[model samples]
Target: ATTATGGTVPLTDALELAQQGLPWLMVFDHAGVPLHLGRTKRLATPAQRLALIAALRGCSRPGCDAPASLCAVHHVRDWNTHGDTDIENLTLACDRCHAMVHDGPGGWKTVTLDQDSQFPGRTGWIAPPHIDPTATPRVNHRHHTSELLATTLARIHEQRNQEREQRQRWLSSHTRHTHAA
Candidate 1:
């Protein structure tokens, strides 16, 4: 497929390229019948890019410090994988980091953390098992240190609360057994 810049893009990348550049795309069935218009939630508009810049602040790859201005909006689920261009499915990634993501075993993976996670609505990077044995998905807090601190404190508080509850349960159970005795 050809882009508006007169450059040729692979068929797999055409949708993403069009989403970033074209206002809308029309689809036709094999018989030339009109299909669906693709303008809805398929383009990463300027507003969406700005929102991503504010949220991600920079490349979503963990430990990468590339600034947001030097990054491109990337689909977390991937355009070819039926991923929409919505803001929630988007994150910023530098050229280097962007190329590192793929379906291969050595490639990196990006996902949107669930709302109940330590970092909700954030892009998480899962490294290959060779790089990280546990394959834990981690977020980059380089551009937003405050969030790192906040999440850490929240985890500590939650752990302490769980410990306290466990202790209370043990004490209550011991007291009941003593009374029964």
Candidate 2:
């Protein structure tokens, strides 16, 4: 494993550094020659997706009203363009927003922001040569609105609790039926 400074260390040490917030490059070497390119087939795991939904609460598009379950995970950068498939690059977008990202009226650039109007998180901006060059760029905030976020969290908790209770009831009914048999 190599740190950003070009110093080599054990893989465990590199992972520890990364967990501590230091970015590291993953490289494959053969005979002291670099063999791997800076690309990865990354996808947010199911657990990560659930956590992301709980965090953001829904689609990240500013005006979108779609719920998290109805949104699709989007990569900020295209994998073809050598983007990593990780949470750092992932956000949920509704179908319309996703279409605008891939094929749109104006070219859209996905961005990670320090802070935004809705939240201090990810965003998207229109690039030059856009259809409405005179229009002010707008950022989507469906997932970033603090007010909606609170409600979303409540909804998620309620949904989970309901599902848990349903499962428990099913299990108890099954157990009772088995004992009677």
Question: What lDDT does each candidate get?
Answer: 0.77, 0.60
Best by TM-score: 1
Question: For residues 1-181, what per-residue lDDT tens digits would candidate 1 score against the true structure?
Answer: 3332223468768777666886555553432233555545734487577556545557889999888778998999999999998878988999999999999869999999997887777789999988988888898877767677777899999999999999999999999999999
Error of 2 at 13 (Å): 41
Stretches of model 2 off by over 4 angstroms after superposition? 1-44, 103-105, 115-119, 127-139, 147-181
User: What is every candidate's alpha-carbon RMSD to the true fold?
Assistant: 13.4, 17.4
- Give the per-residue lDDT digits (tens) of candidate 2, residues 1-181: 5332223479888667767864323443322223432234443376446445544456676677777777787887776887777766777777877777754456555665555444345545454454546534455554344456666998999999999999999999999999999
Candidate 1's TM-score: 0.62
lDDT computed for candidate 1: 0.77
Backbone atom clashes (below 3 Å) for every candidate: 0, 4
